[model samples]
Target: MTDIRIDIREKVFPAVGQAAAHAAIQDFHLTLHSGEFVCLVGPSGCGKTTLLNIVAGLDRDYRGEIRIGRQQALPKIGYIFQNPRLLPWRTVRQNIELVLQESSAGNTVDFLLEAMRLTRFQHVYPERLSLGMSRRVAIIRAFAIDPELLLMDEPFVSLDPPTARQVRELLLDLWRKRPHTVLFVTHDLREAIALADRLIFLSPSPMSVIGDIRVPIERHLRQDENEIEAFRRRLLDGAPHIKQLL
Candidate 1:
């Protein structure tokens, strides 16, 4: 893990033909320390995903500076999107192997599968697994890449509450074993509180950092109902705007 700096003075998508340039991010500056978990929370369509894309180098038509590690060589990045985006035809193990190269020698896949409790389903196809299982496979795949930074975009958006909680627990466990710089984007305030070491609130569209709050409780203590409720009440009392996003 290494220090990463994101300094985006402005990011605009050029107009195609007669359309006007769409501004997605403006004057957004953030620095993430090694192995820190930071969550980006904001309203719908607030360009949270766009910011993640820019950081991931998926979108280049933007004005910004994103520096990774200490050198010009970009660190490995693992991205998990809203959907699992798995190959329906591939088995869970095969899907995990897809991102692995021959030169990359490690027991990462085995370790991740064991840690995530996915060893039993290694031979299962993506379509045969439940939504939760599919999402878990996607997560394992990301970790298999042995990334220095992990970017997740609403990874548990559509699951039942119980399933989502399970996934979150699994994520925390994996991260505890091997921490990486994580930038997670979601609109769920409670989820943000549960997972992030720091919470970054963004404005609507043409998003910019509006607030940055550090979670005081330890990661293991986050699952306590008393702590969660207390944090929720605190947010409602001090940060009403964030409560309204709920």
Candidate 2:
């Protein structure tokens, strides 16, 4: 088996200065292996993003341990937030290069620029690029670090249906080229099933694992209308409650 492993045990987080002290994750636990594409799905306000932040070492107020492999639980992580969050003043290429420079991996900028198909808009500032183009730059910036784990928090949430579909395909292509453990958080069941090897569902608030389903489809499968619809149906079957929302 691969040496890469992610283990989260009894994780919990409480919001501070709130009328009602809310628990974001109550005893949440999971294990992930290398090259696995895992998608986390849940209703709104389920603390999915909070859990991701903890794993990424952005939030340290949580209980329980997160271990990677047999080592001391430290793994380089790349985070993609809901919005592109690119600097308006910087061009597309400059924004990506900034992240690369931060990671001291400036040499990888050229490769990432081509891989993300942002070469054409390399000199275009964030304000000049379309929403989809900006998001693509963000994705490339995250991946440029060559992180062992990639945490994507609804990175395509703001795109239109067609644009989102294209981005999904592009992401899959990138995943194939560079295999890493990916934890993608999204509310869209279809997107989850279409991209992930395993789908994990969380309960409402104070989230806990409600369901775990393995998608048997191959990664090479084309994302056609029929395939997407079938995958969506399969995901709904795995989590019946999701049917009402769809």
Candidate 3:
């Protein structure tokens, strides 16, 4: 497990011909502690993805520093995108096996495939699997690397309610077993409440942290709609402004 410290003073995208330069993120920063699950919640197109890109070291045309633990070099990072960006040519098992850097990844690959209930589809390619099934494969691939820090960008965005809930359970199950640092980006406040140990709210673009809190209800109680609704009511009663964006 590793602690991540991020300090992004600004991130700007250059003008595209007639369009003006857009500042997606400015003065954005976050610190993720070792082995904790933290969710960044904000409105759509609010630069949540941009912040993840900075933290993941994907976009470098920014002014800031991101330090994972004590190292200058990056460790093995596992990322799950907004879509199942699996290699179409590869089998489910093969897609997972590709990112592995060591021999021990085989055992992990086997365990995660069985755990995600994708053993029967291990030999199937991405094109053949349903959306829900493909999402399962993506989850397996992310965990197969046994990464120290996992970054997820709305991994359950388009799924139907039941399927999304199932996938969320599977992800948390993997997180519990692996126990590593996770920086999950999401727009759904309810989903954030259900998944995170701590939740940080962000303002709409040129975003910055507006509020932060630990989940009041236990993980087990989160599934009960009554409890979830009650918590939401209590929270919103105190801060009516947040309800508008959420």
Candidate 4:
């Protein structure tokens, strides 16, 4: 059994002053085993990102108990946002190396550069790199830390379809090589279905877990368009609210 279990009891927050109190996450409970890849999908403002923030310990203002294994969930979180938040002054390798430096895990720099296919542009600054390369660098920076949990907030949202697909493939390959408990938040149902071992659907604002669907298809089949499409259709059938989002 994996050494991670997240239990979110009740998380409520005020919505910009207080016209009405909005429960960002109400009775949200999720159990994620280690080495599991879970994707969260929902309509906009459904508290998907809010839930991730709670798990990451970015926002402890809410009420809940988040635990990893027998210990309280520590702050060893790696976040990959929609934008490739890289420093313009630093080169690709330098940016990745900086993350390693924080942990004193210098050995991972080379491996991450190779894994992310950023070796060719190692010395290039963020401005010199293309959007895809910058995104890859951000991913490497996140993984370089060897985090216990990785939280991705629609990491590929800014890319074109082809670039996004490539990044997704790269992400899966890296995840396979170094398994970690991952909570990925995305609006794309197909992307979520392709990459996740389990699919979690959130309702509209003041989000709650409305559906939990296990994707039985093999992760290796993610590259197969037909299989991915079929699985996506099945997932949509299970979560009709998701279909409404489209």
Candidate 5:
């Protein structure tokens, strides 16, 4: 687990093609405590992905300060993108092992495969697997290395309700077993409430922090559909702005 402090003063995109130069993120500040699950919720086309990219060191052309731990050490990072991004040629187990070293890759792979219910498909190729299966493989691959900081960008989008629910449960199970600081970005308010310990809402274009809400439901009660719905209703009814943007 790792503590993360992010203070992005301004993140501007250079003019390209017909699009003019503009600020995607501005005056955004957040601190993720170790082993906490935080969700970023906002409108589509906002700077959610931009923020994740900055934190993951994918885009360095930005003015900000991102520190990990007390002395600012580089933390072990795991990223799950919108798509699975798995190697189609490799088997499910091989694709997961691709990110782990000899020291880190062992029973960890088998444990994750079994936890995610992918043991039967471990030898199967990515092309033969369904999208949900691919997503599960991508998830375990991220967990295989035992990352201290996990960054996810709307990883469960476009799936059917049943598939999405099952995947969410699997992800929660993995998270409970291996606690880590998670910075997850999602568009679904209910999903955010169900998964996140804290929720951060962003503005439309010049993305900035608009709301910070802590989920009030107990961890054990989060699985109940009625509890989730009731909590979501109370949260939305109390905050009109959050309801509008989310």
Candidate 6:
């Protein structure tokens, strides 16, 4: 188990010829304990994804220090993007196996498939699966690698309401089993309320942490509609500006 420390002093996107540059994050300091599920929310185009990219080490042109526990080596990171980025040609089981090839975790593909209720669809290709099912496979693939840190970028976005709720439940189940240190990005305040141990709110642009609200209710209580609504109100009251975006 490894804790994370992120101290991003500044991050800038340089101008491409005539296009003006933009500041994505500035003086953004955050920390995540092992097994903590943290959610990031803000107005659209506020560089939430940019912040995830930096933490995942995909974009390194920035002035900052990101340390993971005490390990000098880079942590193994798993990412679930907005779209289910599974290979179109590969079957669901094969997609998960691809990630497992490098991992020491044995027989994880089948276990995760069953856990996510994708066992019957293991042999199906990405195109054959529904949007929700594909996303489940995508999640299974991420966890198959047993990553030290998981970064999810609106994994349930754009789905129909019912389907989105189903996926959220499935995600919660899988998360409870492993409890990997997770940083999830989302635009939905309710979804953040349902999943996060702590909700981190960012400013509109030139992203910076404006509020960090801990979810008052326990994880189990989130399933209760009344509790969910109550917590939602608490969040809005604490960060009134968030209501404007919603």
Which candidate number has the best TM-score? Answer: 5
Candidate 6 CA-lDDT value? 0.87
Which is the leading candidate under lDDT?
A: 5
Pairwise lDDT winner, candidates 1 and 4? 1
* Deviating ranges (above 4 Å) for candidate 2: 1-18, 101-107, 238-246
Ten consecutive residues with minimal summed lDDT in candidate 4? 1-10
Predicted candidate 6 versus true structure: per-residue lDDT over 1-246, tens digit per residue = 778998889999999999899888888999988998999989999989999998889998999888977754457899999989888988888888887765654468778888899989989888888999989988998988888899999999889989988989999999889779999999988889889999998987788888888887887788787888987887788666777766
TM-score of each: 0.93, 0.89, 0.94, 0.91, 0.96, 0.95
Error of 6 at 191 (Å): 0.5
Report the C-alpha lDDT of model 5 over 125-187, residue by residue, as the tens digit: 999999999999999988887888899999999999899999999999999999888999999
Q: List the residue pairs that clash in candidate 1.
A: none
> How many backbone collisions does model 5 have?
0
Q: Using alpha carbons, what is the TM-score of model 5?
A: 0.96
TM-score of model 3 vs. true structure: 0.94
- Rank order by lDDT, top first? 5, 1, 6, 3, 4, 2
lDDT of 2 at 95: 83
Error of 4 at 88 (Å): 1.4
**Please, what are the lDDT tens digits per residue for candidate 4 over residues 142-201?**
988888889999999878999999988898889888887898999888898889989888
Query: Which has the higher TM-score value, candidate number 3 or candidate number 5?
Result: 5
- Tens-digit lDDT track for model 2 on 1-246? 244443444445435676556666776767777888999988898888888888888887766767766665658888999988999988887887786655665558777777778778889888888888888888898888788889999999879999999888888888788788899999987788789888888887667877777888776674755776787776677667756543
Model 3 residue 235 lDDT score: 77
Task: Name the TM-score of candidate 4.
Answer: 0.91
Task: For candidate 5, give the lDDT.
Answer: 0.90
